[model samples]
Target: MEVDLGEPQMLAIGQLADRTGLSVSAIRFYEARGLVTALRNRGGQRRFLRSEIRRLSFILIAQQLGFTLGQIREQLAALPQGRAPTQQDWARISRSFRNSLDERIDGLVRLRDRLDGCIGCGCLSLRKCALYNPDDRLGRLGPGPRLLLGDAPSEPAISPAAAIGSS
Candidate 1:
């Protein structure tokens, strides 16, 4: 259902949970984490704006996409508070989020391409492992598959000819 933004529609905590498909505890947790806000009614009951449904939905989607709570919070911070976000507001945040997702997708593709070969596995078993970290030399570059983690080698670690010959 489309929310009438001009209406002063307030949802009880239970209603908000029902609308967002989130458990009451989960909604409270998100509220505590600053992802959502709740206002106290005259009876001291928590109330949420109808717009919170969209915010909670976005949170769920972002989490599914592997965004951390902090990252999701940063994105949601772009949205207006205490009011329904306008289309332009959502558009701006989505454009920023799309860039992040695109970068992650590119990294995944690069990882897939390298999976057939060494992938900076640090095994040093291959004759010409591009990320040959013999004796853990790349350990100085930090932990876990430095090359695969986007660390650059001082020189071209493997020539195109060598990479082809290895396969």
Candidate 2:
């Protein structure tokens, strides 16, 4: 039951499950998917290297970032067994995820800017706003904002002169 920390040790399935906070079934699933590999005992039970703990942790973190199992596998493929991941390997993976995170942040910023513009414009109806009618040709387009908001139609446009001095 005592693990020797001085040497490279192999752990049983139960111990690995406990150490990784993963169910035995889930560990087996990872093994089957080639995300983690284990050696077979003479009795055919699986034995995992202690390093698998770190690998499993990485897998969980990658999954949280919305990477598919296949994508994680592809990223991890660059790492070899019996050696820690090199700086180059880490950089490559980091670059891939960084690009994805940057894209998500850009989209959120764009959405926030659009919402801020709507607030400043005092336009409750998205369909009838000037921001929605970028080209000012919604009438010819037949029922909808053609350029900006591009959602649904609003009330018909009234002439500016008619409403200028009216109470």
Candidate 3:
């Protein structure tokens, strides 16, 4: 249950699972997915380096943020081999994920702004609203309230205020 951060220490699978809060099978799954690696003892039981705790923590956090195993693998591949990651390594990985995070944030902000604009309008027509017809470059795309703001015409010069407020 104890991790010696200063030295390269081996942790039994159970210890690793307890520390990481992942089931043994889930830890094995991560290994199979190449998110973690462990050495086998002479008896063929898996033994993990203490560093793996941090790695598994990162994997779990990334998965919570909607990253696929492949994306997590790609990010982990950037770390220096045979050593714990330096702050610079972490910064580099953060930069890699920053763009996607920013895009998601920006999309949410746009949706929030749109929702604020729609509160009084009450258009509720998908065909007319840009929120629903995002593909037309007139509305926003994706599933959700944005797509159901109002049924606007396929090709009309209707202002957003008019579209949502119209009866």
Best by TM-score: 1
Tens digits of per-residue lDDT for model 3, 1-167 = 96666767899989999999999999999999888888898999999988889899999988897879998999899987667777899899999989988877776666676664432133444443344343344334333343234333355455667767642
Checking candidate 2 for backbone clashes, the offending pairs are none
Deviation from native of the Cα of residue 94 in model 1, angstroms: 2.1
User: Runs in model 2 with CA error above 4 Å?
Assistant: 1-6, 82-92, 108-167
TM-score of each: 0.73, 0.59, 0.67
Q: Tell me the lDDT of candidate 2.
A: 0.68
How far off is residue 72 in model 1, in Å? 2.1
Q: Indicate which candidate wins on lDDT.
A: 1
TM-score sort, best first = 1, 3, 2
Query: Which regions of candidate 1 are displaced past 4 Å?
Result: 1-5, 126-143, 151-166
Question: lDDT scores for all predictions?
Answer: 0.82, 0.68, 0.73
Sorted on lDDT, best first, the list reads: 1, 3, 2
What is candidate 2's CA lDDT for residue 26?
90
Quality of model 3 by C-alpha lDDT: 0.73
